[model samples]
Each structure stands twice: as C-alpha cells, then as structure tokens.
Target: MTKNSAWTILAVIGAIVIAWFLVNVLFSLVAFVVKLILVAIVAVIVYVVMRVFVGGRDDRR
Candidate 1:
C-alpha cells in the first residue's frame, strides 16, 4: 500500500476505537444512573410502608 493509504487506514481505525470507547462509557453511565434511581424508589417505598404500619401502633397508647 502507499504511505498515504497506510496513514488513512490508521486514522480510521483510531477513530473507530475512540468511538467504541465513548459509546461504552455512555452506556455504563446510563446504567449506573438507572440503578441508583431504582434503589432510591425502593427505599422510599419501604420507608412509607413501615411508617404506615409501625407509626399507628404508637397512637393506640
């Protein structure tokens, strides 16, 4: 191959690798955020349920 062609191929490969890395990083960030939101929702639900059930017992006294 010509010298110019070799350089072009290398540039294309480098760009593809960079793009792949960026995509993976973005996907991982999205997944982490989703997990955090889910955990928060579950914690809130549990707290509400416990308060409803446990707090009423104190009023019976």
Candidate 2:
C-alpha cells in the first residue's frame, strides 16, 4: 500500500497493455496481406482459364 509500489504496479500494467495492442496490430496486418495474396492468386487462375477457353476466336476473319 505504499506510494512506490503502486506506481510500479501501474507501470507494469501499462506495459502489458501496450504490448497487447502492438501484437494485435501486427496480426491484423499479416491477415490483410494474406487476403491480398489469395485474391491475386485467384485472379491469375481466372485469367489463365479464360485465355485457354476464349483466346482463339479472333482469327477466323
């Protein structure tokens, strides 16, 4: 119940809170990057499929 002990406890709690916030932010950024990479892979697959199916119809003229 002394003054110095109270300040030390408060400092420890503050450090834990800040660390948690930083970890959450980092995970969110990683998730966003994964989503973007998945979207890009899907787009490339669709493009290749479309070219295979529709890329030969312009030479009959």
Tell how far residue 13 is off in model 1, in angstroms. Answer: 0.7
The residue ranges of model 1 lying beyond 4 angstroms of the native Cα positions read none
Candidate 2 on 1-61: residue-level lDDT in tens? 9999999999999999999999999999999999999999999999999998899567877
Residue pairs with backbone atoms closer than 3 Å in model 1 (clashes) = none
- Tell me the TM-score of each prediction against the true structure: 0.87, 0.83
Q: Which candidate is the best by TM-score?
A: 1
User: Where in model 2 is the C-alpha error above 4 Å?
Assistant: 58-61
Local accuracy of candidate 1 as per-residue lDDT tens digits, 1-61: 9999999999999999999999999999999999999999999999999998988678555
Backbone clash numbers for all candidates listed:
0, 0
Model 2 residue 12 CA deviation in Å = 1.0
Worst 10 residues of 1 by lDDT: 52-61
